[model samples]
Target: MIAIQDVKKLSSEEYLSQEKTNLIKHEYINGEVYEMPGASSAHVTIAGNMFFLLKSHLKGSNCRVYNADMKVRIDRLNVFYYPDVIVTCSEEDKGLNYYKKYPQIIIEVLSDSTESFDRGDKFADYRKIESLREYVLISQSKKRVDSFTKQDNNLWILESFSEEENLVIKSVNFNCAVSSLYEDLD
Candidate 1:
């Protein structure tokens, strides 16, 4: 999806109102809104698998897992994103029903069109969230997972997982097999 940077900048109120009435979802960053594209089957399956694994692992815990429909707000960066998978254990986030401001983990399933955005600008924006401990990227075409864990306010360390290995997610306290994420896909 193309970022509508040419369009007039919208205020948070205007974007929120328009987003509620519009059928297509849009992400807001620094006053610009970008219309989001629909996810492919592989993207959906991988995201679903991660959500299931995280949810199952966090059962009886205070953490809650949300799918792509839920919005995440990076207050410091003034950005909003519909991450493929969002896990928040913060009690501050639980009080809100519409959008979460304190997400512990955010996962994005990469596609050909969005891989760069997810890895570059989007990751930069997500890093502004103080509660974000881990940001994960999953490849749709390969059994690979990349995780960036925050070492400090300004330091983030990258860790990668290959096909045969399981991604040990410390933020959410779980391990998910990379192969299981692409089970039905070639």
Candidate 2:
């Protein structure tokens, strides 16, 4: 099990600069840090597939898609997370070194090693961002997609899609046949 520590005292700059190199990725929350494990082949495939589809669809538009290395900041919570895939339509986020805010769309390709946290505390932390419109969790082992969209009253609604049907992401005004998201994964 990963040990949890209190991190309410560290500055964002201090946290970013303190770590020079590491074998694994680490997520910084408040002042605490947790090591992230390497993803499996299936997980990578899903993420890559989503990136390709999103990238093509968002072309010539203000929105852009970023891969795993991009860091998204939740300033209100003083946290930084490396989302598997992030889509941003805000002009301020276009050339920023670090996203000092939440993304319009955040997607995590679920894997055995990180499914629980990805759906639990991580989602909780992400909700704190006011700019975030949708949170998506894509199953790496099965053809499933879970989407959480923020409602008019700032509440979130959960929507799930399987292989049998199509899914639409109202947040980004994007839609695709479900098969496109799970292609080449067998």
Candidate 3:
């Protein structure tokens, strides 16, 4: 596994200030900071496709889709990370300027470097968000998605879609063919 750059320890406030001034992106967990890596071409393409599809479906509605530039505050874990795509329908979250707390859906497009972290520790932190209903992970190596949806008893059910299957996002009543997510590639 490749090492993700680990900067010096910083407070949550300190990290935010650094992020505001610095051009690069970083994720803060506890007091440690990890610089976010650049996305692979495949990663970027998939994320772009999903964002456009989500934005179009949600137009004129309260739901809004955001790119990775938006930071999400995981208060329970004292972490701040940028997801590939985030959809928030909460009025309170919309009122905020810097970060969102109540995102209904968070999508992360996986690359070789970040897939394990995105699927493991990062997911654990995301699950702590009370307002989060779905977490979706899209694979850059293949046409696949693994979605976790929170159930009534707090258990998250995993649904995997691959090949030509349709990916369904029940939170927003949205579904799209998996092939659409990988429109252009080498």
Between which residue pairs do clashes occur in model 1? Answer: none
Say which candidate scores most in lDDT.
3
| TM-scores, all models, native as reference | 0.93, 0.89, 0.94
For 1-186, candidate 1 gives per-residue lDDT tens digits of 567756688887787878888899999887989999989988999999989989899999999999999999877777888999999999998888778999999999999999999999899888878888999999987789999999865699999999999899987668878888888774
> Which of the two, 1 or 2, has more TM-score?
1
Deviation in angstroms for 170 in model 3?
0.2
In candidate 3, what residue range of length 10 has the lowest lDDT sum?
1-10
Residue pairs in clash, model 3: none
Give the Cα lDDT of each candidate. Answer: 0.89, 0.83, 0.90
Error of 2 at 17 (Å): 1.7
* Count of backbone collisions in candidate 3: 0
Scored by TM-score, the top model is 3
lDDT, residue 145, candidate 1: 98
Candidate 2 residue spans exceeding 4 A from truth: 1-10, 19-23
lDDT of 2: 0.83
